[model samples]
Target: MPLILFNKPFQVLCQFSPQEGRESLADYLAIPNIYPAGRLDADSEGLMLLTDDGKLQHKIAHPDHKEAKTYLVQVDGVVDAAALARLQAPLDLGDFVTKPCKAVQIAEPAWLWPRNPPIRARADKPTSWIAITLEEGKNRQVRRMTAAVGLPTLRLMRSSIGAFSLATHPLMPGEFVEVEAEALRVGG
Candidate 1:
């Protein structure tokens, strides 16, 4: 079985198949039979895992597995302690209540690459970076949670999922590296 770690770029679809004019993993990945373990929205960027093993994919993607996914978020405001607290608490996103997770303000990571086309800038408002870890992967959950707490997410990047991290296996945007399948299995 093949396990690949890819650094997904902004505006790139998560799947390996073609998607009209928009860019997809096919543009960068040509490894047949491997599919993305989890998805990142077109607007989001960073580490993504791909695999041919179904069980490993399930272990990585399933919410019941409770594998923590860490995101480095840049929001459009100075996030105070109160705001961080709100982010750490169980947030009600109307459709579902988010499970309590780790949220902390972090200095910008040096490894980060500037996004192409760039995030919108506000001459008056400032931006802050925060690291948030969530076990449940809801659709656009991080963005919604930050917005609910009065901070709008400007950029979101999944830096790690469980023990697999972008730091440990570095890949620039649109680049990928293959890893052993056993290395990714939970507690393997």
Candidate 2:
């Protein structure tokens, strides 16, 4: 079995199968028989784990395991204590209620690479950075959470999953590395 860590860039589709005009995993990764353990939408960027093991993938992606996934987000507003507090609470988000999660305002990470097409810059509109850790992965949950708190997400990055962190394993966008598969217990 092979385990891979890939730094997926913005605008690249999460799937390996080719899509019209958009770049997909195949454009970056060549190793066969491997699939992403979890998915980050094309708009989001950062660390992703891929493996050939089905059980390992389920453990990583399934909400049942509650493996922590942290996101470093850039929101459109100047985040305040109130906004952070709201994010940490189990506020309703229409279709479903989110689980309580950790949300804190943070300084922009020095390790961050500029997006291919940088986020919009406005002299009067200041942006804020936040680090949020959630056990359940919902579609556009981080973005929606920030928006509900009045801080629309300008950029979102999945920096870590469980013990693996992009901060420790820095790879430029579109780069990937193969690693040991023993990191997960799938034999049970």
Candidate 3:
């Protein structure tokens, strides 16, 4: 089985399946016999994993593995400390209590590539940056977590998944790379 690391772009579905009137894995990934290990939402962007190995996919996608994932989130509000603190604490999502996670404020930088369709800008209001890390990724967890605490995620980008990081390789929108399968092994 071979492993591939990709920095997915905005509006791209995480699968090869056809998305009506929308972009999907087919638009970006050309490698044969590879499938996404997990997913990043179509509206969200950043590090994605692909592999031909079923076991590897399960190891990365299954919550039991508790593999850490990190994201750089831009929120609509100022995202005060109180909100940031709540992100680090457990969240009650009705079905279950989310595990504690990590979050911190980050200064804005000009290095990130501009999202193809940029988030709407509010003249009076402003955007803020937050770095969030989670061991278990629930559906729209980061977005939901932020929304629960009064800040809605305006934009989201997964910077890292387990050992692989986008900062190191620097994937522009719609670009990806194939890494040695062993490089993505959790405990190799």
Candidate 4:
């Protein structure tokens, strides 16, 4: 089976099922029988994988496989080394302690498309970007992590998972490309 790499837009629901007035995967993809292997929250935007292959979907989305997921996070602060260090070191998130992960301050990516409605802008406050990679992507982990360090997340975008990446396969919102399942570092 083939894999669909979709760049989901902000506010789009992650599932195909209808949800009141909001748009869902069904609106963007016409491919039948394929379902999202993983998901992004309705408020976040980034790369999402959809496939009909059950085992492949499990490897990619299940936490036990330990596939790395990297996020380009825009936080509500002038990000500092202290925050980066805190992100790298695992601070307990109440429910779980994250395994140590790579975190670094980064310039806002030039390749990124501007969000449609856009995040709030305030003259009194500033924002910064950081790249954080973690193997486990539980519910709102990145946002909760940033908030734990006093740097609330303003925008979140997943740039890569395992071997597939946006750097190699740049996609605008609502676009998708099919790739050979074997080409993925995971499996068919």
> Quick one: best lDDT, which candidate?
4
Q: Rate the local accuracy (lDDT) of all candidates.
A: 0.89, 0.90, 0.85, 0.90
Q: How accurate locally is residue 133 in candidate 1, as Cα lDDT from 0 to 100? A: 96
- What does candidate 2's lDDT look like per residue over 1-188, in tens digits? 66798999999989999988999999998888789999999999998999988888877788877778899999998999999899999979999889999999999999899998999999999999999999998899999999998999999999988777887788999998877766543344
Lowest-sum lDDT 10-residue window in model 3: 179-188
Q: Per-residue alpha-carbon lDDT of model 4 for 1-51, expressed as tens digits?
A: 679999999999999999999999999999998988888999999999899
After superposition, candidate 2 runs with Cα above 4 Å error: 184-187
Candidate 1 C-alpha error for residue 151, in Å = 0.5
- Against the correct fold, how does model 1 do in TM-score? 0.95
Clashing pairs in 2: none
Clashing pairs in 1: none
TM-score of each: 0.95, 0.96, 0.94, 0.96
* Candidate 2 C-alpha error for residue 49, in Å: 0.8
Model 3 TM-score on a 0 to 1 scale: 0.94
Clashes per model (N, Cα, C within 3 A): 0, 0, 0, 0
